[model samples]
Target: MGSLSASYFERAQEVIPGGVNSPVRAFKSVGGSPLFIQSAKGAYLKDVDGKEYIDLIGSWGPMLFGQAHPSIENAVRDALSKGFSFGAPSYNEVLIAEKIVSMIPSIEKVRLVNSGTEATMAAIRLARAYTKRDKIIKFEGCYHGHGDSFLIAAGSGVATLGTPDSPGVTVSTAKDTLTAVYNDLSSLRNLFEANPTDISAVILEPVVGNMGLVIPEPGFIEGIQQLCKTYGSLLIFDEVMTGFRLSSSGYQGLTNIQPDLTTLGKIIGGGLPVGAYGGKAEIMNMIAPAGPVYQAGTLSGNPLATSAGLAMLNLISEHPEVYDALNQKGKALAEGIRQQLSELQIDGFVNQIGSMFTLFFTNKAVKNFSDAKTSDTAKFGIYFREMLNQGVYLPPSQFESWFLSAALDEAHIDHILKASRIALEKTLMA
Candidate 1:
C-alpha cells in the first residue's frame, strides 16, 4: 500500500519464495503484495511507508491486550536483562505454568514449548504413548499446526493454497491420522466405529477457527468427549487459537467440557512465540523423566517467552473484564456487519464466537468445513481487498478467522462498519 512496502515486496520476491515466510501473508488469495509492517501500538499497525491500519488480525490472536502493551514490553525487557534462554529451566516458566494452571482448570501440569506445532506434536506423542495406540482422530479443517500427523486435512495456509493434504506427507503418516467433520457428531461416530481400538487421541478446535470460525453445535464437543471416554482415547482440545481468545478458560469454559489434554499458544505468549500442553497428571506424568515418552526442545522454557506469558496471564486473570470486553467488541462487529450485509442485499452468513468470526458469502450456515466451502470465495476476496484499501485490515483468506483484540473500541467498530458498508457496496457492484 506504501512505497516502502511495494519496494520491500519487490525485493523480497527475488529472494523469499512468494516474498513471505508464511504462505498466507503473500496475499495470493486476497490479491496484492502484503503490507510490510513497521511497528504497532494499541490497535493499529504502521506499515514501513507510514500507512496505519486498524489491526483486526491481532497477530493471529496473540495480541489480546493489543500490540505493544507497555506491561508486556516491560516484562520482556526485564526478562532480557536477566538473560534469554539458558537451555534449561527458568523460574518464569514455572510462574507462567502456575498462572495457566490457576486460570484453566483442565491444565494440571504443563510442558512449555516454542510454538503451537511443538505443543501439538508433543501432545500427540504423549497420547500415543499413554494409550499404546498408533492413530489419531482430528476434525477436518481444525488445524493443529503443520505437524505431519495434523496435515491430513488442515486449514489455514494449506486451505489458502487449496491443498487439503500436502504432497510430501507419506501414506504411513496419513494413515495414522483420521479425519472427521466438525460440528457433525454422526461423522465422528462413524469414524470411531470404522476404526475400532486404535485411536490414541481425538483432537479438534473446540471453537473451530481455522476453517473460518465454525462454532460447534451444542453437544458436539460433549459427544466427542463421550466417544473418547468409551474408546479409551484421549480427548485433546487444540486450544491453540481459541485458548485465551475465547474465554479465560477457553472453549472448555464456553462448552463446559474438560479435555484430557489441551494445547495452548497465541495469547499465552502475549505476542511472543510460545506454546504449552498439559492434562490429567497421570497422562502428563508419562511424558518426561517420570515416564518413557520423550519430548524435548532447546528453547522449551525460554525465559523471554515465559516472562511475556506471565505478564499476559496475570493481567487476564486479575481482570476478567478483558474477556467480557472482547466478547462485547466481537458481538458489536458481527451484529454491525450483519446489518450492513442485509442493507446491501448481500447473501452472507457470519459465524462467530467471542473474538473469532468469518463472513461467508453464502446463505447456508457454515457449521463445518463443507458448509464453509460453499461460500462465494471470489466475492469475499474482493470484499477483503476493498476493506484493506479502506484501511480496515482483515484475514487475507476467506477461510481464516478474523482475530479481534481487546484493544478495539466503539470508534474502531464504527470505522470498520463504515469500511464494510463501502466494501460491500463495491463488491455488489462488481
Candidate 2:
C-alpha cells in the first residue's frame, strides 16, 4: 500500500516522534505518507519502494553537484578510512576553513560549527561580544536557525506551520531582537533610532530565501548596509541557503554587498552536516581563545564533512560553469512555470535568484515576509501533491525554495515541465 510509507511511518511513530527526525520530512504539510528514501543519485531519489522522483529540494539546497557526487563521495570515503573523529584539530577542518575563506570575499577568518543554526548562533554571540551591545535586529521571515533570538516572525518551519512566535522564547529575548520588515528601510532606521547604543547587529537572509525565495527589492540590501555603517552596528548576512549556491562568494557577489559577518551552511557541506561563520579578522577575533565570547563544537569540522566540503568547494572554485549551468536550468524552470501559470490564468508570482526559486500562488508582490504570507498556500498544496504523483519531488511547503542542481539536464527539465502543467491544471480545478 502506497510504497512502504504507511507501514514505515507507523513503525517510526513509536521510535521517532512525528515519524521523522525533521518535522517537514514527515510530510505533515504535503498531506501524504512520507516517502522513506532509500538512496539518491544525481537529481533523482529512490524511495523504499524503488520509485524514482526528480529531487527539487536538493536536501534543502546542500546537494549543489546533486546527490552522491563522486568527488565528494570519494573524499568522504578517504576520510572515513582515516578514522572518523579525533575531537581535536583535524587538518581537513583547517583545509575546509581556508577553502571557505578563499571563496567567500568577506570572510577573512573563520570558525566551524555543525549546522547553520550553530553558525548563526555563534555569529550573534560574536557580534554581541565585539560590540558589547545586548540588542539586535532581525527581519520578519528571515530565519537564522531555530535559535531563540530568531523565533519572532521567522520563516521556513515557523511560516509553514503558521507559528511565528514560539512559546518558549522569552519576551526579554524577543525585545533584544527588534523586528523589521524585509526590503523596508524605514523600519530598520526607526528601530536603530529607538534602540540607539543598545543595538549590536542587524542579521538577515540577505536574499530572504526562507520566506519563499523573496529577492531583496533593488537597493534594499545596500540601504541596510548604509544604515549599519552609519549606526556602527554590525551587518550579519545569514547566507545559510544562499552561500555557495548563489555564487562562489554567495549572495554578496550577486548584490555587491560586503557584510561584516556571514553565516554559511548548506552547499558548503557537500551534502554532509557543516556550518561556518566568518568575517573580518577584527570581529572574528572576538570569538574563542583569541577573545572572550565562547563557541565550540567537537564535531564542528568532522573530517568526513570537511573533506567532502573541500572537494565541493574546490570544484566550484575551478569550474564556475556549475553555477552558470544551474542558473540557465533555473531560468528555464522559472520561465516554464510562469508560462504555465499565465496560460491557466492563475494569480501567482515566481520569485527567483540563480538556482533558488519559488512559484508562490499569490497575487501579492512577495517583497517581504508579510507579502509572502499572502500566498495561496492551499492551492500550492494541490499543485505539490499533483507534482509528486507525477514523479517530481518538491519541498512540501510553499514557503521554501526549490533548489536546482547541475545534475538536472534536458530530460529532467522536460519531465518537470510536463508534470507541472498537470499540477497547475489540478490546482485550478481544485
RMSD of each: 1.2, 1.0
Clashes of 2: 0
lDDT of 1 at 143: 89
Question: What TM-score would each prediction reach against the true structure?
Answer: 0.98, 0.98
Q: What is the lDDT of candidate 2?
A: 0.89
lDDT of 1 by residue, 1-430 (tens): 4488889999999999889998989889888788999999999998988888999889999998889888999999999998877987788877888888888899899999999999999999999998999999998898899889999888888988999999888999999999998988888899889877999999988888888888878788889999999888999999998898778888898766899999999889998999999998999999878888888889887889888888988778777888778888888889999998888789999987777878999988898888888888889889999998899889898889998787888999899999999999988888
Model 2: worst 10 consecutive residues (lDDT sum): 23-32
What TM-score number comes out for model 1?
A: 0.98
In candidate 2 the C-alpha lDDT for residue 239 amounts to 93
Runs in model 2 lying further than 4 Å from the true structure = none
RMSD of 2: 1.0
lDDT of 2 by residue, 1-430 (tens): 3558678999999999888887677767668778888999999999988889999989999999889999989999999999998889888888888888888889999998899999999999989888889899999999889999999889998888789988999988888888999889999999999988888999999877787898988889999999988888999999999999989999898777889999999888899899999999999988878988899888888888889899999889878988888888988989998999889899999987789989998987789888888888888889999999999999989889999998999899999999999999998788
